[model samples]
Target: MRATRLNLMRAFAALVIVTLLAGCGFKLRGSNGSYRMPFHTIFLGVPDTSALGTELKRNLRAADDVVVLDKAEGADVQLVVISETRGRQILSLNNLGRVREYLLTYTFNFRVMDAKGAELLPATEITLKRSMEFNEQEVLAKEAEANLLYRDMQSDLVQQILRRLAAMKAPAPQASVPAK
Candidate 1:
């Protein structure tokens, strides 16, 4: 009889917790449904094999209504990747002039345009930087860590691009007035 009562209490508590969470509008990340793209079809000007290009394509393809095109001919929107660059600089040095810390940076530039060559979105640059402590004894491990950080930053950049594309607003239609 006691065990049955305890189970009932536990079930009631769990139900209350779930009800509170639902009332608070709690949502898990990436569960907010597909991001709506302004254009149904988009052409990516970056090479398909590039890291950023591949990530962007994969993300765009995930959206239910988006279609990524290879050629620009029939696409409604074109995304031109202007530049992608990565750099590393020493952030700190030991007394013996050995590097103790480094800053890694990745910068990507891109623009969006319409089929008629009109700029839909101006050229913009996104930069991501990370700092890490360096040890001479862990050179190989540090190199691997840097590569992992870059890959993580690339994924973040892709998500940012997708959010920007989803948030973009189409120009309002204008009403023409007859000339007097």
Candidate 2:
């Protein structure tokens, strides 16, 4: 009887906490990366093999079943990726002139526009960089670590994109001028 009472109390407490959080308008957008976009239909111009693209697509699906159009003809917004670049540079050298630290960079440029090409979100560039210490003794391990860091950056970029979409305002309706 005591154990049952304890379990019931715990459940009640959890329910109260969830209700309070909801009342406070606190939403946790983590892991699932769900967002509320201003537009309903969107066309994303990205390849299937792209990690960021895949993550973005998943998030969009979670966002109220947003329409992912293959063509931009009927989309409310068309996302265009201008460029994606990855680079590495030597940051420091050891006493023997060997590399000690390296900087890895990821740059992404994108824009959102209507089917007629009016800009919704102008061209925005997001760049991420991480400094890695290298050791000749652990070449394979260091390579793996670099790959992990890059993957982490890709995930961050996806979340950033989602936040931007969530914050975007709906496009203003165009008014036609009467012919002279």
Best by TM-score: 1
Q: lDDT (0-100) at residue 120 of candidate 1?
A: 80
Candidate 2 per-residue C-alpha lDDT over 1-180 given as tens digits, one digit per residue, 9 for 90 to 100: 999999999999999999999899886655455777888889999987988888888878879858888887778888999999888999999999999999999999999997678888999999999999999999999999999999999988888998888788886554556999
lDDT per prediction? 0.87, 0.88
Q: Please give the distance, in angstroms, between residue 124's alpha carbon in candidate 1 and its true position after superposition.
A: 0.5
Question: Which residue pairs collide, candidate 1?
Answer: none
Candidate 1, TM-score vs. the true structure? 0.81
List the candidate 1 regions with Cα displacement exceeding 4 Å. 1-15, 23-25, 28-33, 171-180
For candidate 2, what is the TM-score?
Answer: 0.78
Best by lDDT: 2
What's each prediction's TM-score?
Answer: 0.81, 0.78
Pairs of residues at least 3 apart in sequence or in different chains that clash in candidate 2: none
- 1-180 per-residue lDDT for model 1 (tens digits): 999999999999999999999999998966774687878888999986798899889889989788999899778888898999999999999999999999999999999888777888899899999998899999999999999999999988898888878877653333456999
User: Candidate 2, overall lDDT?
Assistant: 0.88
